[model samples]
Target chain A: MSDNAAPIQLFAKKARVYPKRVWGTFRKLKWASMVVLLGIYYLAPFLRWDRGPHAPDQAILIDMPARRAYFFFIEIWPQEVYYLTGILILAAVALFFVTSLFGRVWCGYACPQTVWTDLFVWVERIVQGDRVKRMRLAEARWGFEKIWKMALTHSLWLVIGLLTGGAWVFYFNDAPTLLEQIIHFDVPWGVMSWVLALTFSTYLMAGFAREQVCMYMCPYSRFQSAMFDKDTLIIGYDEKRGEPRGKYKKGDSWDDRGHCIDCTACVQVCPTGIDIREGLQMECIACGLCVDACDGIMDKLGLPRGLIRYDTTHNQEAREAGLKERSHLMRPRTVYYTAIITLVGAVMLFGLMNRAPVELHVLYDRNPLFVKLSDGRIRNGYDVKILNKAHEDKVYSLSVKGLENVEIRVQGAGEIKADQLHVYADSVGHFRVFVVADKPADARENVDFRLEEVGGANAADYDGVFMSGKP
Target chain B: MSKNNEIDKVSGVETTGHTWDGIKELNNPAPRWWLIVFYITVIWSIGYWVVYPAWPTLSGDGERGGTQGTMGWTQYDQLKEQQAEIRARKSAYLERFENASFAEIRSDEELYAFAVAGGAAAFKDNCATCHGTGGAGSAGYPNLNDDDWLWGGDVESIHETIRVGIRSPHEETRLSEMPPFGDMLSGEEIADVADHVLALSGRAEDSEAGAQVFADNCASCHGDNGLGDSALGAPNLADAIWFYGSEKGDIMSQVRKPKHGVMPTWEARLDANTIRQLAIYVHSLGGGEE
Candidate 1:
């Protein structure tokens, strides 16, 4: 501690960073990914699929009011929400598998934050000029030129944000009808409010939050190192070859000095404003932009490239120890992640293929458990619900088993097989049934009720109690 | 203040020289954009105060309580506007429901839904106290969501029941009385008759004696098979549904001195539209007979 230290102030000023543009392998990759991902996001809602006249035509739709979700050829009901959980687990494991091999690669290339931020920056460069001009304009007094440029940049950002948010709402409703309703200003207030909220958040996050989201807001950044090991590929600086870093002229002494000229070119092209020479850091997105920058400088100086490159810590250590560098991709962690991913995928596929076309729920009446009729017969009432999951109308015949001398009577449909009840496609049909039988003193507590489709697709069975003697 | 400020040794960044337990506090500022957002929200809040109902006054005298802002907005006004939006959305259905007969409303799916929703709201406010939520009735109150009906289960029968009610003071109320036999018969005879009635429901071990008594006295209103008479509003005694109770003692008490239930006349209280809605809603509760 300094003896002449001044009194502590609560806040310190922030240092703003203005990153310069550069051309490299990673930059080209990022550009290609941005175009592809944004294209898919913007165009997916317009894609159409035919499902006869009974269902909407949007290829991917979540019909919330009807409690149904349609994805291309598949339709999911509320009871099948476990499929979503399965998908989330699959995605998480895939991410872990990738992260174990290549550290922070997803964060750099495919993260929504990174993609949108890149787009925002590209727009900013087009509207406000390059890094130097932007910094000058930022430091310069607010003039009319600055105001117009800033306004134009923000307006374009808002447009992109609007498109992003608009695309999201299209998934929940019939896309064409909802689009018409939105155009006519006839949509529900909730829809308009959600669109507005999502638009503002997107604009704020992509345009302004930028690096702050990666540095502080995103939980993925905090726990990312948990998936990383010494063997994982990361953006690293060859300090032994680059440092003792200093400026060099054309004919400077090459006997003792490292190849690095201390140009700070790596820092100039960095999106997160981190110094790669400071070694591997949490801020490094592993974008490899610095590698291209340093490689360009090394070419000019006639030095071998890769002073800053994608390398594993173990490889770097081995190289320093005068051993050949190697990578281990088939590690135990990666194998385990791959195995789990494959297993989960196979199980979900099987489940979807063998999904039941019909479901039944039987609830025995509780108030008066059993009614003893004048003819010495005991009658039990049940409320049965049958879900017909097929795409057309169906007729189902109801029956009961697990009891002797039982007689079944559905309220609307009679006991005979010819008196089949018609159930609408993709809907549930409710019926009140009375199961009358002799009071067998030695009968089991529960009985099975079976509903078979009349010369149709499937069957469903439900278990109900045969309450006797009392409530 | 400048005397206590210094650059941190490790990071070479300036720190607020205040140290606690040998740990110094870095003075790094919050992001500039975050500060701008904070300022924007402050301005927005001030603007909100100007337009919305925000402040409170000592008098507490306003149209909807609290200090009225410049825009003169109230929560009640917003609620009314929201309701108007919903009404606009369902205007076609509402128009049909207003003009259609009960049969027509029942036949049309859209109109039926509109009526049922309106009836549900009305039922929650007026009928749930006695009829139970979703009309899963308690003892003595009929479970509307069942195949059993005292008078009838048709749409018109339900409409009539709601309009006049059962045992109400209204002139058109469905009226019935089971004369108390407590004073007319001996305790043994009452017990025997209750057992026979239980036998009719297949609950008793023997009903020979009570069957004789039932044939002599109860068979007039209750059919010989105890199937009940809808015209007289008598319940089917052999069905699992019981209005009063299912206990043997409950049956004996009913044979001795029956407790009659009364439902208030809705026509005297609710509007015609509401009554029709209730009738449609009750009819659609999975128990309506064709």
Candidate 2:
């Protein structure tokens, strides 16, 4: 719009950031979430589940060796991979639910990047002083004191990293035992290596990479626009109200300009250091620290609050035009997100309820589908697979029915004195059984294979085409 | 860190200065000690990756992925170490349980204490699923460690129950199956016979017309006394130990429907020594019928 053709665009000069601390409701929420989420991650592994004597006692463990995953009361085996799928769906929809309701709440508060960076910043404040001092220290001449500052800060960061790494491996095994093992310098190689790798990454990401992860590497940051709309409550600066901004003395009245004193305190406290007055940028985490800072400034200046606040474009425009609209939280997109979240949750619960403890699989012996004995009886062979899904073994008998006048024969199964064999718990057992179809040698396609536990008749049936030259 | 380029060192590690969000570029070198530690760990991990079963394939060519390191270290070896530790502890318990006479061990002061500690843990792991923790009885699963036993509760019988287990196909395993009364009698006739059978156990909800059918057909295994035969694995009808259930409907269902419980063969799954130990362990649980 600037009609000065001779003027070439000069890229905005970068300013070194030193965000001063600000506290308010959003900050408190962020703090509480950080504590709770981080607490669960670090402490969960130390909790114990007495799964009798046989199973590992570490609750919420991911037992890689045994291929078991335990979460409190729920134990999932590798075979129950659908549970993992359900979990992934639950995670996705749950995110949608959270996003729709609070609007970027996860990004502002619960995102690992936000939480860990908060922690690292706290540690940095404790060791090297606040943002101002840290900035000054970095800019200070290379002296022994500066060296000490860097060493102290980096050391603290690495300690947090080490703790993070240590906590991560605990999820895989008994945390207390692993900790002891690590201290003794005899942790399992796989575990130790993973801990080392995780520690290094945590240190680098939280300490050095910092906000760059969300800015450059995070996929969520790149595509969050697709999920956003004008109605969504975003960290917004009311330009109509704050524009014509100019410096105001402590109590001086200015009727010509807006309430904004242009103190730029909001900019100074912003974690991303982006001026919200420029409109919603992809970089804004919507942390509301700016809102808190601006509110503090407006209160001191005796002006109406909300220089920067959670608001919408539509609401801002309506307010300016003197016709207000009620805030809409139940938009179609939010409704869709909630419905999807509930649907996925219901499906997961249903799946958990209907899970079977015992199952069966039958493989037909295809090499010789059927054989004709000299006695003129036809025999169909089958490889019956029995799965004992229970924690205990099963003694199930192999029997046949659904075909008129058929005698069941099992090759390895001792004389028909009994029909059952012992199947191990959490394992599959295969038996080669021969069914003497009493039908003529010309019979075909009409038979059922029944596996019944002798005396204990929890029977399973498999229907196979009884072949005899296709009838 | 840039792909396919070595650091010239003259122009040091300068970051690309594009700050967005609060993330800014820092012009600094990776800590020398940090990089050294990183390299060492990476090299060590690669060495481990090259030597272990790190990858899986459907073709069963898993060995092709690893170098088969000089020490031949494997997950199996680690598992073996754990197993060895377990075995060491187990041997102590097994020696005391299997070697000591039940009465002698049961009566002794210290020996009983040790057996209780070891047996409690073992039962929790193995027997608790079916036998119930602390030998508490469920419908189908029996109450071990109780005086009530169908076969015999003597040391030998107890050992036998534990060795082969009831209704198992462990070669010398205990075995039995109730004949399908459905095949033997018409549905109506079976109900009559069921009533008669229930009557023997003082649980008659019907007439005595079908008592002859029981005396004629069922007495062979159930005994003329209706107390049941141990050799035939016939359940004692007189006692309250109903294998399926103890209710009138349950008893009638058994008479008409019949209840047959199966015990898996312990032979292939458990080692001979372990089976011996388990037998003694079950015997100590009390239902080792003499």
Candidate 3:
């Protein structure tokens, strides 16, 4: 350590970014994506599907109290949580496939953070004017116009955040009922806490954090380059054509000069405030807004478009060499990701289609595993749980096989039939069943409890063990 | 420590003035927002210490309990509050359970389910020591799940038996005593009677000499056909189930000197509602009669 050296500062203040409003093809594409994504998120909970009389009609709901997840006609029980794993795998592989072809497409278009921040910036622009006016107001004194405009912008951002948070909670409950509760200011504490938490996070992340979230916080931005190869499409600058730049008048000659005029249009319109002329960087979201800005400038100057554009490293090299440019969409990474997505999607679809309506679980008694009745028969007590997922009450006849002279007795079933057990719709029937069998040759015997729906095709079987005293 | 004050020539960045071997660290600062978050967490920890019990304290009079924070919260108090909430939820079912008769409780499905759940919990805590976890009793303790019962298997009878207990210290206990016949009968006579008792259950051939002794000694309480009377707490002899044992030696020993089992009355030990739940639970263990 040096004694007379200048003191080292450990923290650097953030440089605020003010992205000027730009209009082009990619800007219009971003707008369309934001509208569609937000529309689906806010309106899907209100959609309804008729699940007959016994089940809830909400189209997409996660009923925590009931331990059921209903997505349109498909209902998932807690035991079938592997479906969620399959969905996650499918989503991950699909993202990989898209990223291998078009770099950071998910980050630029579909990500909630980018979409909400763009919406927030638009609200700011509407209230405080565009980039120059906003910077002027920030530097100006706190006058009545500045205060009211800033307050209005923040108030609008908060309202948007509240709506976003309120929409999120609707997925876990009946939307109409929760909306009514919210209208009356009678929301439950659990739902109210979640709504408030989400509201605060959305406001902070969208209104204040902005591009810093993608730069310093998001893991996707840090690791997404791993999916990129030389063939992957990325936003870049053509340094071979745009270097040795200088300002030009209307009548300037085109000899001994590059096409770039050093206008800084790409940098001014960048959401993250990074220059594409600096070459490929991690901060670039591949949003193509720079391409739009450059194309508009080229139209004005009678020069060709794509001084800064979406291009692969290989294509750029080929163009510089005066060769043809080609896209490789069927690379090894893309093929592997596609195969995984297909395999997981197929397995999930097959499981959903073949889901059984009945499930049987048999728990053998732990203490005194077998009781010797006075009649020389060994009786084993079992707690049998029958999950009847049908919409109507079902009667199931239970029988035990692989044991000699097995007699079944169900407690509290009231003699409708010896083997018939009535289970209510969409609920578990818990029965204390005692299976009495004649003394077997061995001390223990493997048995199967077969439960078949009465006059129906649905059936379930559970493998169990019958214990007797050692011979 | 020495002042280098030199910039690295290759990267054109200043050094942090510390060198390890040939390496000099760059003078790149972290983002200000990260430092601001660290400061916020530090302040939050200070606020947490004020709001929660964090430091130990000693009183002027030498008491050593820790300082009670502004919230005045403790884990024991939280546990007590949670337990109170559970009791409040169960009071609705417990009130009905206490008032309803055994038949009324049995007929109502919801009330029966509640009673059974309560009974199962209470059984594990209080009764599992003697009667097994599944109510399969050992040599002396009666298995509540079996059809053969000494003091009736109906819900009401089970309730009464649990309340008073057999041969217990309670004044109204179901009292029964089999007089020891070691001096009254010869050893040969006791053996013959044991054979006749086993014969009744088809365990032995009909013993002509033992029949007269069993008729004179056991017929009054065990019945002539050996179907036991529930009121007298006498076990049935004709059934294959045996309290002591079914062997000839066991029967002879029992006849010579009978061993009486004592069940403690639960009325004083547990509340009335818990006793009723226990009775319902024991009766529902696959064995209660109409």
Candidate topping TM-score: 3
lDDT of 3 by residue, B191-265 (tens): 888888888878888787789888888889888988889989888898878898879999999889999998989
**Deviating ranges (above 4 Å) for candidate 2:** A1-18, A49-58, A366-382, A402-405, A409-418, A425-427, A430-471, B1-290
For candidate 2, what is the DockQ-based docking class?
A: incorrect
What does candidate 2 score on TM?
0.58
Candidate 2: which pairs clash?
A: A397-A420, B145-B285, B145-B286, B152-B289, B152-B290, B153-B288, B153-B289, B153-B290, B154-B290, B158-B288
Please provide, for model 1 over B1-290, each residue's C-alpha lDDT reduced to its tens digit, 9 standing for 90 to 100: 36457677555567887789998888888999999999999999999898888977778575556657899888889999999999798776767778998767766656766887898899888888888766767888877776788889887898899999999989999998998889888888888888877776677765687788778878888888788987898877776667888778998899889999999999989988889888877766556777
Candidate 1 per-residue lDDT over residues A1-471, each given as its tens digit: 563555555554455566778787888998998999988877777789988766778888888999998888878899999999988999999998899899888999899999998889889999898888999998889999999999999999999888888888988877888899988989888777878888899899998888888887888888888888888999989988876888999888877888889899999878888899998788788888888889989888888989999999999999899999898998898999999999999998998999899988889877445655435567777778889888788899888877778877764322223248788988988876777787766433677778899997588888777877653
lDDT of each: 0.82, 0.70, 0.88
lDDT of 1 at B256: 88
Q: List, residue by residue over B1-290, the lDDT tens digit for candidate 2.
A: 34423322333333456458955454576889999999999999987667765645556656554455655777778899999999897777667766777566656645555655555665677777776665655677765544456666665675566667776767787777777677777766666766766666566664565767777778888887567876777766665456676665676567666666766665566555455545555654423433
How would the candidate models be sorted by lDDT, starting from the highest? 3, 1, 2
**lDDT digits (tens) for residues A388-425 of candidate 2:** 65556668766554565677654331232226667776
- Whole-model lDDT, candidate 3? 0.88
Q: RMSD for all candidates, in order, please.
A: 6.2, 18.0, 4.9
Output the number of the DockQ-best candidate: 3
Native contacts present in each candidate (fraction): 0.02, 0.00, 0.23
Query: TM-scores of the models, in the given order?
Result: 0.76, 0.58, 0.87
Q: Is candidate 2 or 3 superior in TM-score?
A: 3
